[model samples]
Target: ICNTVYRRIPLRGVCTKCGGNLTLTVHERSIKKYLEISKMLTEKYDLPGYARQRIKLVEKSIESLFTNDKVKVTKLSDFL
Candidate 1:
């Protein structure tokens, strides 16, 4: 799914007119879809140190990519 959407995107960048946002969203979703399961499996099995580190690196990269750092709070009262 990610490959198909990625292929459709032009070399320059994502084009919003051609569902670029949707394409990127789908690609990210597909990439993260199996992340949890992979983590679980790694924990369940006695994988090598290198393998565990690789998964942790991937998780951190994905989180950094998808995380919004500049969120604005609209209403402090809402939280309380």
Candidate 2:
């Protein structure tokens, strides 16, 4: 009996009914694109060449998820 709000479900529309910190948009293209960008950025910063940059990259990616203005989507595919 997981409440949709607590379950990390994609946002059903533009407004967040819960008014929580993270607002997810229910759109596949947006979510997929975010994942792809996160992955590519992760790989770039996680490489041996950028050993010191791993932390930076990871932080950036996480922040991007919340701060990205291009699209709003929280990755809930793991649950799907």
lDDT of 1 by residue, 1-80 (tens): 23344546566565545534334554678888789888888889978888899999999999888777897667889889
User: Model 2, which residues run further than 4 Å from truth?
Assistant: 1-25, 47-80
Residue 64, candidate 2: alpha-carbon lDDT: 69
Please report the candidate that would top lDDT against the real structure. Answer: 1
Candidate 1: segments with Cα more than 4 A from true spot: 1-23, 27-29, 72-80
Error of 1 at 35 (Å): 0.9
lDDT scores in order: 0.74, 0.57
C-alpha lDDT (0 to 100) for residue 10 of candidate 1: 67
Global CA lDDT computed for model 1 = 0.74
What C-alpha lDDT, on a 0 to 100 scale, does residue 69 get in candidate 1? 86
